[model samples]
Target: MSVLSAKFGHRICGLKDGRLRDIKTSSSNVRNMEELEAERAAQKIEYAAQVKMEQRIHNKLKIVKQQFNSILQSWHHSMHQLRGKVPGFV
Candidate 1:
């Protein structure tokens, strides 16, 4: 059996067989297309925020690495200069 409903779409009969879960009862509680679109918008916003945060972290890491390398090079240069000043230092 089948029922054509303009408000709730097609309703299948006999399939329910007097079962509670098989019946929709009403369209009020059922999720609509608008709700699904809203959820997708929220997810896209969340994803963009996460990507921005990750990019900031990556940029900070690069700056710290550059500073460390600069310090190491300066220290090495000073050590070589000190060695040249020492007497009989090969």
Candidate 2:
């Protein structure tokens, strides 16, 4: 006998046996697909938020680096002026 025959025997000849099982399986499959879609949507939202946060942090660091470079240039200019004032300084 086939697998279907073993499971349902003469019941397979009726409309309720195999049909009902197929319906139940299809319904559960739909529910599982919906749940998986919802989870994927949530993950996408989280990933977008994370990318935005990383961009903000990168911009902040760029500003900090610019400020540090400005300060370093100013310090170097002051040192050059002091060297000029000091006698025998090359």
> All candidates' TM-scores?
0.58, 0.64
Task: Give lDDT per model, in order.
Answer: 0.71, 0.70
Candidate 1 TM-score over all chains jointly: 0.58
As for candidate 1, its clashing pairs are: none
User: Can you write out model 2's per-residue Cα lDDT over 26-82, one digit (the tens) per residue?
Assistant: 555666767998999999999999999999999999999999999999999988998
lDDT of 2: 0.70
What shift in Å separates residue 74 of candidate 1 from its native position after superposition? 0.5
Q: In candidate 1, what residue range of length 10 has the lowest lDDT sum?
A: 1-10
Model 1 stretches astray by more than 4 angstroms: 1-32, 87-90
